[model samples]
Target: MDIATLYNANINNITTAKNAFDVLATTFGKATEAWQHEIADRLTAEHWTGTTATSAGTQIKNLGSELQAAHQELSFVSKALADAAEGFAAAQAHLISALDDAKNAKLNVAPDGRLTWDNESTSPNFAGTDAEATAKEISKRITAALNEADHADQAIEQRLSHLAYNASSGTGLDAATVKQDQAAVAARDQVPATGTDPDGVKRWWDGLTEAQQQRFILNHPDQVGNLDGVPAIARDQANRINLQRSKQDLQLQLDHLGPEPAHTVKAGRGSVENADYSAWRTKHDDLQEKLHSINDIESRLAGDKLKFRDNTPAFLLGFDTKGKGRAIVSVNNPDTADNVVTFVPGTTSRFGTASGDVDKADEMARAAKQADSTKTTATIAWVGYDAPQSILPEAAYESWAQNAEKDLARFQIGLRSTHEGTPSHNVLMGHSYGSTTVGYTMRDHNLPVDDVVLVGSPGVGVDHAKDLNIDPSHVYVARGGDDIGIAIAAGTLNFGLDPTWDSFGAKHLPAGNSDHNHYWVKDSPSVRAFGEVAAGTWRL
Candidate 1:
């Protein structure tokens, strides 16, 4: 019963646990590979229509069961290894107790394995003299060992959770199958079984005058008869032809009935030539005045602000009015402007705040500027429009989405004009509710862009980036680790929440894995990656 003996036993225990972990890691890795292949094969069968619907369903169920078993095995091994590591410390405790006994027996061993202490013969107590130092060293070693064990446990747990996350989402691989099924159902519903067309031939009959409609129905009684058993396309074509004939007959009746009602032209009206000249002059004057006013405003504004000073150009636009919101443009190299980053802020963004000169989009523009000073990048803080005040009120009312569409249109027109002659790598970056704004905008307006980056986004409501009219390959998303918004979006339990960040379909850069949306620092990997997008160095 000695200190050296206990330490050696504890070391052996640790070695055994480490060996167990190694074996478990290998087994779990193989299980993961197998499950991955199974899922892929099942999907391939589904994709190619190689299996019946029932068969695919059965395969999915079986795969899920297998994945669950694999996951359980991994979890079990991880826990066992962790427990064994803890048991090693417990064995060390027993060794410590034995050492106390040996010390009480008035014996101690030196580093060279020689007996160095004899408590019975000492003038002063030898055991008490060295107990404090020995105990301190033992406690330090125990703390270090415990920390290593905890670190190892955490590493395994994180890997398991990440694997579980992937297995559950099945995003990129299954989205097309789901979309196809939904589309098929909708197409089936739109075609009626009992009628030739859903609109019906009755609509064609109803278009004529009452007498004419009745006469036509009688003359074309067979066409007016039940349309069932007729092809929908044939019925549709027949209805269209009948409507065209009825319109011609009605026009003939109108032509025959019309000639008597027009009584006169005013006697004082001038000759055609004189009157036309006067009208033409009036129109010319009006257009001239408009042109002059526009020129005046353009000249005044041009003198007041720097004109294309940076490679970036500022966009000034008004909502329901002309000329109001401010946008600042700065390029990394005024001489060789390369990348252009347009920041669209969400919810209550304005210019010249007490905290700074811009809000929302402008705030992001500032961050872009700070991110890289020499990258020949242009950061535009665009208060694209007076955005809604909050998401809650807007979320409750769907009309906000319509307004967002309009704002997107206006911003795009303005952006196109601002970049009139310049070719720069353009990115439309949105944050928070701004992402939703961008989604609606891109869907409604075709803005020329190289990349679209969403940060701290809520659900964008687009199933995919392509749904927003942007190339799916160019869409990028990032969420910080602590971002609370990511949790909200992910847990919305609705597929419409922006899945780009969590799915494999689009390129989503790593956000700091933050818990809160607002606190992700610019220095974090996610932000730096975003910065790379802004710089046009990162391919989406």
Candidate 2:
């Protein structure tokens, strides 16, 4: 396809198909769920009994499962159409802009994207001295647009080819649809060689239609929920869908396990003799822990949007259920706030054990409000990285901080890129080894925060405040008199120089003999002082 042909591509037809498939997917899923509820209502353990009842229940479940599988297939196709439409739209816009530039330069662009001098003679258009160079630039852009459109077309053709695929399955048409989708999935693997810059991500997001964005969020929530540079509200909504879906999946897995055995037989050195029992036990335990972690997150959300001390809604900016898990949540929209403070919790604050950290973020917002009620403040609990799981084994390694650098930088950049109003005063704080993550990220990336706060730090991975990315005067440190482990770690382990040390030349906050874990205690001087800093009213 050439520039003119691609520019006039029928994206509207793809969008119409996408909308139709989207509705079909939603109907299938809702119908399955409704049927499940009806089955549960009818199949009472006390009343429904017998071989016939058991057979009926099993068949009923298979029907629901088939519908659910069909929903997945339809959703994938819908998203494929949405992706194709957006890709074509972007290419069309690119071509249009290039054409406009060519027209302004008084160049005649052909249908095949060839450019010539508009004066009907080989003459320069007065852009640069060389007319050939200007023509080449316009021609290059047109070529790029055409190439982009071709790539989109190739992907869509493969994704839509599932319509003709057949699979040999006893479960019939739904089974065939599910099987075909697997090949379609493999076909659309265009690959991600390098990540887009956060600014570029914002530009792409800005170019998307609302319907396109919604399809992305609904069909690919895992990607959209964690993506930087997207709006917080959209991220929150996507994450909530992800959270509920995960919980439901875990619950289903658990229910499928049925009841546990009365006794377990052990063999050899201590392993279970029964393979079935061992498998069931292992699966049950893993699922239970994951579910528990999810429950903790749900509690933090407080049945709806995470409510702070005030009625302000907190947004779940990101979440994951894998391994130790991760969560990034903010207690108010940073886009609308006058001040934004992001608190990175240190050791032992994994998703399952993050309630305390979330509470601290909440307290930080309240403290900021107390300092300057006139200004709106948003405090975020950023558990975006897998912090050192324990002090003895994990905290001692700088590797954890090293691994988190890119994600942390992107997250901070996202906050800056997505802000809607006047630039807000931004503060980044880290406690204990989290200070290590902040320090590494700062050293590596030009994080957009205005100030840095290191509290109860082992070290900031810098020998002096001047070594940090920000001005040395913008660095602030607060250390509790009773923060013994951190003090010892800073003095001996050599993560770097202690920020609170006078030689380091960083500003100070009053710690006043507090402990390592007491910084965010309600109404405490420490939380209030941190809040004041966030509110842009703190003094040395």
> Which candidate tops lDDT?
2
Clashes of each: 14, 0
Instruction: List runs of model 1 lying over 4 Å from the truth.
Output: 1-336, 350-375, 420-422, 489-495, 501-504, 515-520
Model 1 lDDT, full chain set: 0.49
Candidate 1 lDDT over residue span 314-422, tens digit each: 2222211112232232323211345666666655543322012122333333345555665455454544455665556544343544565664554444343334246
**Candidate models: Cα lDDT each:** 0.49, 0.80
lDDT of 2 by residue, 206-269 (tens): 5454445666788878877888888898889899999899899889989998888644566766
Ten contiguous residues minimizing lDDT sum, candidate 1:
315-324
